[model samples]
Target chain A: MLTSCTNAIILTVNGDEHMLVVEPNELLINVLRNELGLTGSKYGCGTGQCGACTVLIDGEPALACVTLAVACDGKEIVTIEGIARPDGGLHPIQEEFLGENAVQCGFCTPGMILMAGDLLKRNPHPTEPEIRHHIKGNICRCTGYNGIVRAIQHAAARMAEPAAADGPDLVKEAR
Target chain B: MKLESYVRPAGLEEALAVLAAPGPKALVFAGGTDLVPMMRKMRMNGTLLNGDSPRVILDLSKLDELCGIRKAGGMLEIGAATTMGVIAADPSVKKLVPVLAAAAASVGSPLVRNRATLGGNLVTASPSADTAPALLAAGAVVRLAGAEGGPRELPLSEFFVAYRKTALQPGEIVTHVLVPLAGRPVAGRFEKVGLRNADAISVVCAACEIELEGSTCRAARIGLGAVAAVPVRALAVEAALLGREITADVAAECARLVHEHISPIDDVRASAQYRGWVAEAVVARMITDTAREAGA
Candidate 1:
């Protein structure tokens, strides 16, 4: 029989590796929010229904609420805090969300942005239905999803262009 | 949940040994989509500590042997720990069993599918499980490995004994699901009726695989979910379609026979009468679509 013991797990979060000891029952969201203080990923619902606690594990969008911290040992995690430009600028998706007025209460914004980023990475040019379908797991009470859908489409269009062709200034001017 | 220990076994043998051990209660952990929520509910209800013994979560996610998909000798062998996202996106699965792939794609949502495993879905034994009907229609079998014996295989039809119950014995873990590939060309379709398009549990679901010779049905397999205690095969419906020239009228007639075989119950998502109607409609649509695709 196995005995109760704290497990030392290694997690590479946003390119930084942290070696920490955690209890077996500790959830990934708890460790991230409470231990690391990466509060960008919200805890809207403890259940997996709400995608508010979504984070990218090995480049796939997974629910952190249901994921145990021990199971994520030695895996690379990218929370909403990690989803920015290298020079401390907002990502295209984030900019588009702002430009499109997708953020209402902002509770669902982080997860929505992360999910939109993951979707664009997989499919650079997604149709409107595909974009809506991809982000179906995320729930937004205020926006009614119209602004979010528009923002994702705009992000897809912006991301499809060459790096030098479009600048963040254009998004700022539009907003 | 109050898990005493989280054991990530390095190998399948070690996992089996841990499960076969006498004292502590070990719950097999895969994609935590189902078990974690259930555990949390149990914890909330203060039922997690019913027994004095400590609880261990035997995580099988790290085992590479349980996380792949391959084709061997006319069977698509999917590892038990293979995520639904992988299965849904797999090219091999799409080509061989498109219905299964579609069903996988229709499960919960992208976030849930990224971690939910095929074996976990079967072991949870939910009657509304999306993949169960598709796998049933494809005539899949599960390979089980226990500590005592080497390994054994059981048909997917026999895997579920009742509602929320499976034939999985203690100390035994599902290794892989083997879906037989049809030698001849076949057309299969899967349909799910839920309150919403995504992340909604099926009110009623159906899958149909039809092999046609000219205009006559050579072989047919129909599987239904959420219309019974367990995901079931509509054997009577299948038998009715065999050797018959499938048309709109004939499909409608056979779809009505599904009501005779299934016994659905009223749940939160739908009423029993609504499920019965939806089941017939879905089965009819599946039959007609599959037959058309099979060049009927």
Candidate 2:
């Protein structure tokens, strides 16, 4: 969908700098999946309505499907593949999602986990309603959202531990 | 759409210059939440991507000149490029004009708010634009910077021309929005009804601001969205409320008058009759809520 030559962009994905050539119409989700082979972010609606392609841009949740790759020239982005320890230990949010049976088909997990991770980082002791409010964008067609909300609450409790005080940092590894 | 080039202008002047060029079908975008999807749909329809001429995108995300919220000279000045998330969460907005914050908070969701901009919301000019009614009720003024002349200011009410239209001219960009802080005590309320709790376009939304003096209405402003061609102010209702005591009977009259003022049409989200009824009910609730909050 581009007529001109590819433009150079230096994107810090999962704490690693990758200089790639992208087109003007290329979306962030496409760049993350095709160019970088990080397919953790799913492309559900291609529109912003669905949170299937949600990712973190500067520690805030953004819909990658609507986000242009050209606009994200020098920003730090985090995908679901990056939300784990270097030693292969699962992030607390990821572990809790499993324990709460939040994964039905597992399509919306990446966005849900990242959104919950960002929420816990901002509010270490968010109430149940607050947990539901944070993941409003990420939709789960299978679990009916009860399990997802429960998983976020469980993650908040786990991340509140003194050793895991830095909730988002636990998932943010230096690759 | 097949984009031939992308330009990231460093400043407002450079951006205006890029838009003035006549080679390709150039378009300026801030968040791209709305424009990107429209273009993608155009491409899917086989209309834009395979066209003969090229399409150019002027990315305005890096233009820091149009992104922030500040208070100066007794007004809240919001940069046009400021994201909805930032505006909704800003302490000053939350404290002074909570209705605007509520409207912004009710927008799509966190991800959508993170990327959606105030300028984009206005520029798109959807009849159901979430922030339009709130800004209109607050009496906002928009600042536009163009290529030829110095910046100009226009009241937010006059900025919208028609359905999906605005008063913006070619090569002009929305720079800032000025919202006057009321010197007197005021209470505001905002309400929206959607199909679902989140991520649903508004079926009907209403916002009201009132200034009270000993249980009598000193002044009032009312705005409604999705009931007309453009988000509109309820002049008849505002006129009826002024100088009248805030009461259930007065609110009923104002709510009835709302139906007389708006021209709604049946659409996918709602029926014209449903919008008319909801407009009345929502306005009545907002008026009563704001009156109670103002102790009137």
Candidate 3:
């Protein structure tokens, strides 16, 4: 049996730093939802099978459920709640996801948006297959996945427009 | 089910100190992709039975000693803690061992690949580990480091002993996987038959590597998974292909030999009979495809 240990850690979540005490066994999803009240990242499978708990750890897509809170110390975590602009504006990907009618039950939207954001940031212009491949982990039982794929593609096009007129400066401001 | 302590050792020695501390049982977690879920299930089962689960998790993700993908001394050395995603995208690794890269790519999904480490996959010793078949086909050597022995090397074929078990001794951990690239020009291919195209555990997976000389096979290796207690090299299949021109007839014989060699049991993923059939099919397809790629 492992000896029980709790640790105090500083977590940088969504540009805000929070000092919290966590048990070694506490998962990042629970810490994000219960401790900090950032419930935008949902717990779907709790086994990391579903990507509803996906968050950006240093701009990379990561499942928060399987990830231990203690392991994520000192990393920058960006949840769905953190993607909104300071002026109370929805991020471009969020705007596009809504515009493309990608929300079915909205349970998987946060993860889908984050995952698409990750893909778009890495590849400004991705083919349909690439977008589909990126979000394969994030399951959307509703909308038949066609709309989700279309939403990610649309988000990619909007994000790569090189104009801040219609869309927020997502590439610069978000990351 | 309570976790006792989470230690992120700065170096291998510090990590060994925690592992050899002589108190609570400690387990090494590289990415925690497989370990975390297994731990959760164990904790739940333990709570029901009033038993003890792993208490200490020695997080190895932060250790620089166990995290990299590079070529050194004419070998492609992948650190044990290197994530599957990085391995899949690494240019050098992809160029040297395309089959390993493909196997790494076929694992789970993007999110899982980002967190699943090569060492975690091997140490878990899952018969269906996607990377194992390819690494086994490539003739990779695993490097182990311990508090006592310092470091040692073992062929990947000898690393796995049984289901979910490895040859790792107490306080010893995998440090790097070395893929030797000194011999003949080799071409490889990896194939997986699963319930879905992506994010599904393998019903059967195969990795085939071939060395060719003007439409004749000089050497061949076949690794098959999910058909036995451990990932196995298909020696019978390799024998059928070596020193012979890879052809449709040879491929058919190799398939039959694959079925003869594997001893599969009926599991939730597939029936024993079905696994046997698919195992041969995957190995056959991979061999033919890899041979064709090499112009055999």
Best by DockQ: 1
Clashing pairs in 2: none
Please tell me how candidate 1 rates in CAPRI terms. medium
Model 3's CAPRI class?
Answer: medium
Judged by whole-model lDDT over C-alpha atoms, candidate 2 comes out at 0.85
* C-alpha lDDT (0 to 100) for residue A36 of candidate 2: 94
Comparing 1 and 3 on TM-score, the stronger one: 1
Weakest ten-residue segment in model 2 chain B by summed lDDT:
B45-54
Candidate number with greatest lDDT? 1
Better of 1 and 2 by lDDT: 1
Query: Model 3 over residues B129-192: C-alpha lDDT tens digits?
Result: 9999999899999999988866999999999897777899877889999999887247999899
- Badly placed stretches (over 4 Å) of model 3 are A1-5, A164-175, B45-52
Q: For candidate 1, lDDT tens digit of each residue in B1-296?
A: 36677888878999999989998668888999987777776665534332323478899986899999998878889999999999999998898899989999999989999999999999888899999999999999999999997899999999999878788887888999999875633699999999988789999988989988898998898999999999999998999998999999999999999987799999889999999999999999899999999888
User: What DockQ would candidate 1 receive versus the native complex?
Assistant: 0.59
How close to the true structure is residue B238 of candidate 2, measured as C-alpha lDDT?
Answer: 93
Model 2 Cα shift for residue B111 (angstroms): 0.8
